[model samples]
Target: MNVKMNGFISLVLGIGLLHTASAATHSLKYFYTAVSGDIDYPEFTAVGLVDNGQFMYFDSSTKTAVPKTEWMKREGADYWDSQTQGLIGEHQTFKVNIQTLKDRFNQSKSTGVHVVQRMYGCEWDDDSGATEGFDQYGYDGEDFIAFDLKTTKWIAPAPQAVITKLKWDSNTANNEHRKNYYTQECIDWLKKYMDYGKSTLMRTVRPSVSLFQKTSSSPVTCHATGFYPSDVMVSWQKDGQDHHEDVEYGETLPNDDGTFQKSIHLTMTPEDRKNNKYQCVVQVKGIKDDFIRVLPDQDATNVVPIIGGVVALLLVVVAVVVCVVIWKKRSKKGFVPTSTSDTDSDNSGRAAPQI
Candidate 1:
């Protein structure tokens, strides 16, 4: 069941590693994937993200890296050409890595599809001048091996990766280079890009908060949209106190306009709803005010809903909850997994040593 569950979810979710939110903190990450089999996916692909926003993309088919955001067009063609050349080299390397992994897992002759993926990047806190980095690799929705900075060794959770771990860990110099690249080089690039997109990247937009229910007996949802920077928190409060139990937290998803949207659901009995004073509170990372939405004081048994959503996607919320819990549990067991995706914010972002 786990294998089937992972395979199915991996097809859709890239991998997400939630980070601590701060108004002044920013990130730069790269996600690369190489695939093997008769899949429709690109043989190799790459994406670059800044603060959860994809700024550039490359694929085997395009063979060139292109900016995704208008603000990133501040650079000349030479800048994109340089990025294109770099990804070309990495793409070739990943092609070989994918085949090597197929053989490593004894799936070279199998009809099944396979993928090799890598995510790495750096983060900086402008407010404190603090810096951090992460680099990890995954295969077929499971952890293969990852760099451990504290021990300066490679960790292999699956038996198949032990051999590679031994070989890679033997390269002390390369390990140090990777560490330095992530901590120093990657961060330098991040700051440069942040400066280039300061008007777009550094601005803060507060969310539009909405409290709605499909039906009186159904779960009430607190939805927030049109937010920038992607660090928004939504929670429910009961009788002037914080409420945690029987609540569901949704992912901060990207909107087409470059802003973000998020929702949280509350499940309460009809009796409890009548007895308690409830409100939904929202806070965007850099916003000064907390957006509050008080629940309508109506009988829980009332048939009409307060808000009308022609299309209610409750199943999406369930799927996100289940997938996150599963991968987190697997991560705790020392086996983190990820998907073959073009987007960096997929469900299974590799658990970096959080380095």
Candidate 2:
């Protein structure tokens, strides 16, 4: 499958779902990133998401896997311990992969930074119980390689990764194993995870949608926040026609309270607004009603930026706090190696912290 995570560095992949919408879907994903320098951050870090909702996290510093939600804590220590071990294996592998990538990219002599990242996951269609799996890798914020199940092939998107792809594709047994892992094992784990956090994961929350301008010169942004499952669509219309010009879509992000938020900007001038009717429409996957805000509404101005900025700021603070806590708790006695950093990313889009 073609993975869609694009804004990984800032950690807003802008998107996935949960609560098994009758026609909606949920996803179970894992993101891992390795950096190649001694930065005051995790050398290796991984996160697990169910329907784009993060449930667990692990990093080289803490050397432990921990649950992020109360419902996730239902799993015993053994489960967390097993996850820790699994991430530990991944950490070592990524450490080596970073170096190998450095060599492959001929960046060994470079003084700057380098990174390798992996994001793999499965999406489950709740209505029909259909599942799709994808696996991809990136280097220095660009696409590198991905696995295709139908052909059981490892495809390299970049020429630099061709040699590695050829080597991986040549290994029939390993390819078969990967195929089974994505199709069967990954789905099995995903189902179990949904069950494990059903109370929280099974609920749906509608978004509070708004339309406002940051400044008179700024675009009119359709903002949606405080929704669950993260899968949402915000669009614009002019004179009852679909409007797409100069529209900017933003990354879907998580709030401090575990809800999700997103904003899309529609650029227009005050003069243009007077001649055409403009409306902001929001459609959440499971919620049946459409939330709409027409232009010239008495209350629809000068609110989005303040709200959006506050949400974005709060998210950054939470992320920083979590990262800092993990770093502080990390064991100082472990072997330190050169590696790159990873940003906690999104579902449809593959993203990581820029190296």
Candidate 3:
């Protein structure tokens, strides 16, 4: 009985270990670098690992996951080990199919994190040696060749989102670190444009005063700007009746880039200005039934108080002038000498003459 029980326990332990290994076989962590010339030597160091089918390679500056396909296609494989050298020696060729590396990464099942790849010591040389003329070196030589990902025969599961295209521009002075940083920035800008395009289209209207004239000789013009195409209507109405005869409406002037703008001029007489019932109606294309009132010009209304003040001032001045004339006439008459005093003096003189 003791022997049988020990055997059963050993069998259980073996099965458990096998299960753990199988689970770990489908995951991997790999490092990739973006180089200018060749896969053997890189110009920039972007070292990270991915495991469990998730991109753990977070860019420190952008705080976002690096695009896997971009790094894979542009930089190629950064993993080089003794086994790879041996395979190249046996085959008498340094070329390895890119699909082979991709398959190896997809099938790895290591549970813990592993540093499967590292890229460093990136340099370039354009000057030729004594025997060669202008030999460009570093990552950009024929020393190493990789299979193009698109032309490869192997196929894997489809990605969640297929990136159709990618484009980038970088300064010549950009090094490995700066290239990675700028790549993240470029990706962010593209995403924002995509989001803007996908959002719903919205319509808006802004009213502006084009011309304001209180005089009847000139017309008061009101314009509505910033209206979208297929959403604009402008007209003039006086006393709730369309006044097309007296109003001159200009054709909608299109912006140089094909945007819509409109202006309406309504000439008013003195009688029309006093009535206070003229309005410029703006109806958006979608909101035809809705009534949107642009602010009416109050210059005509404001003139009433000013005119009343001038009339009152004129009346006060006229009254003051009439009172001053009356006072002057009365003063002249009252200051004149009386003839009675002169007669008494004459009578005294006559009595002296008679004596």
Best by TM-score: 2
Better of 1 and 2 by TM-score: 2
RMSD of each: 6.6, 9.2, 47.0
Better-scoring candidate (TM-score), 1 or 3: 1
Candidate ordering by lDDT (highest first): 1, 2, 3
Off by over 4 Å in 2: 1-8, 12-22, 297-355
lDDT by residue for model 3 (1-355), tens: 0112111111111111111112111112122222211222222222221111111232223322333322222222332222232222312211222222223345233232111111111111113211100100111111111111122211111221011011001212222222332233323322332233222122334433244443446566656554543235678777777768677764343232223345677776666666567777776553445444443445534421223433353344333220000011111112221101112110110000000
**Per-residue lDDT of candidate 2, residues 30-128 (tens digit):** 778777664556788887777767788889988999889888887887677767776776788888788787877787776555667776777777678
lDDT of each: 0.68, 0.66, 0.29
TM-score, every prediction: 0.79, 0.81, 0.26
lDDT of 1: 0.68
Q: TM-score of model 1 relative to the true fold?
A: 0.79
In candidate 1, which residue pairs clash? Answer: 14-346, 15-346, 15-347, 15-348, 15-349, 16-347, 16-348, 16-349
Model 3 TM-score, all chains together? 0.26
Task: Estimate the lDDT of model 3.
Answer: 0.29
